[model samples]
Target: MLYKTKGIALSYIRYRESSIIVRVYTEAFGLQSYIVNGVRSAKNKTNRIALFQPLTLLDMVVYHRDDRDLHRLSEVKTPYPFQHIPFEVAKSSLALFVTELLSRTLKEEVGNPHLFRFLLTSIVYLEEATEQYENFHLAFLLQLASYLGFGPENAQEFEDQLRERSLPFLADDAMTDALNTFMSQPIGTPVRLTRAQRADLLDALVAYYRIHFDNLGDVKSLAVLREVLG
Candidate 1:
């Protein structure tokens, strides 16, 4: 069967001599793996490989087999043309880190429309955002936690901890308000978090995920991401 779907490229690896295996999170199917043959020797290598980039949003037509494990791509093209995400170093690095995180965490083949929209919007927000890059990844981490059912329940508790830690970044009223909204609302609402609030929220969320998802283990890229923010 042939299926056309919009997908986000999560990761890819070289396969055999000249082929590649790409993992993508599709809107219709939760997660899927596809094989692209002869990409290394393709005439338009640059354009062809660009579609497999980490977190690249693409529109693709794939040959789907119900009983088979590997799928084949018939055609692919970028769907949400990124203007700054693929070009800017900081933005691109964050994209890579987030894509890797999602590729590891999202293991189900069940359709999740809310998670799909959240990721799609987050990428666009990151591309257009002009705020300090320090908090972008943290905000994403927190939101992802909420989507995964681990978000914090009490803003006052989070705020008290921030106060005890003397985190100056939480002084912003808007940031506080966003954190409050997120803590108060049901999981999956779009709450705008401040850079500082985002950091604190992410710290709490990481702890929660670590407690819940044992396989998360230690995120090595976390140190690199922190270094990049610093």
Candidate 2:
């Protein structure tokens, strides 16, 4: 049966000569993989391939079956075309990191309305914010950890979790203050940190995530994001 759902495009890989298998996190059905044909072919002139870009917010009509692992998209269109992410290098880099993180962590095939709304609002927030977004990904990771059931409540708790897991955390004043701000404040809130401190906080967060997700290796986009943001 077909259903209309809002989805966030997570990632995709080439399937055949002209097809791709794309994973989308749908509001109605959770994470799903869809095989889309002909989007990569030269004869396909509709440019539909752009619809599968990372973190694209899409409104879709899809064919869903409870027993199927891979489903099909009947129709899809961007609900909110990004105004700045595609144009700004830092934002684009952050989007890639966010995409990679989500693709790894969001694996369940069950709908989570609260988590979905968190992700949707966060994405829109990143896209709309014009300044002080370099810390966006850091704040996002902390927020996402809460939704994932392992988040720290404050800077002290963050350090405690690291100690509890035997994970290394830099005990720097700047890093602690910045993390406290990130944990206590909402996304887009202004916070100050040096380049080195920001990098340290990111490493600490990734270490925290690794404690929970055993197989989450080094984030592939981390180097690029660091370079672009710095």
Candidate 3:
């Protein structure tokens, strides 16, 4: 069956000579893999390789079958082209890191319109962000956890527990408040945190996620993001 939906590119791998296997998280179908034929062919101008870039949003029409591992797409285009993420080094790295995290965090191969909307809005915001964004990924991760059904609703309690147990930076009141504020606020909301503080809170959140989700291993982008955003 053919279906029209909005999709956000998560990741893709080169397939054969001129083709690529791309995973797009769609509004109609959650995580769909499509083998885009000739997307990488330098001689072909019709098919776009940029459409498969990490966190690029697209409108797509796809062919689906029951319980199939791979799918086909009939049409795909970016309705809104990113203005900054493509050119800005920090934002580009952030997008790559976020999409990689999403690929691991979101496992279900079914429709999640709410989760999809949250991610779509987040990517747009990240692209347009002009203020402090060193902490943006941390905020995004916490909000995404809510969508994944294991949000840190009362991080203050956990902070106190960590302090009592003498768990590294959690013993610091400043770090504890930073984590609590990040857990409770929306993605765009600003919180006053230093570079070191932001890094600490993010490290804690990443540890928490690893404990909850078995598949979320070491995020390679963390080192680069910290070096750049620091």
Best by lDDT: 2
**lDDT on C-alpha atoms for all candidate structures:** 0.72, 0.89, 0.82
Candidate 3 global CA lDDT score: 0.82
Error of 3 at 217 (Å): 2.2
Error of model 2, residue 42, in angstroms? 1.3
Q: Which predicted model would earn the best TM-score?
A: 2
TM-score of candidate 2 versus the correct structure, residues matched by position: 0.95
lDDT of 1 by residue, 25-96 (tens): 988887899999888774644658777888888998999876777899998899677788788777777787
Per-residue alpha-carbon lDDT of candidate 2 for residues 1-230, written as tens digits (9 for 90 to 100)? 99999999998999989999999999999999999989999999998988888899999999999999999989999979888887888889999999999988998898899999999999999899888899999999998999889888888888988989888786677777788777778888888877877887888888888988998987999999878764
Candidate 1 CA-lDDT value: 0.72
Candidate 3's TM-score = 0.92
Model 2's lDDT to the true fold? 0.89
Candidate 2 positional error at 101, Å: 0.7
Per model, how many backbone clashes are there? 0, 0, 0
**Candidate 3 structure quality by residue, lDDT tens digits, 66-159:** 6798999899999988889989889987887788788888778889999999888889889888987767888888788889987766666555
After the best TM-score superposition of candidate 3, give how far the Cα of residue 223 lies from its true spot, in angstroms. 0.8
Q: For candidate 2, which ten residues in a row score worst on lDDT?
A: 168-177
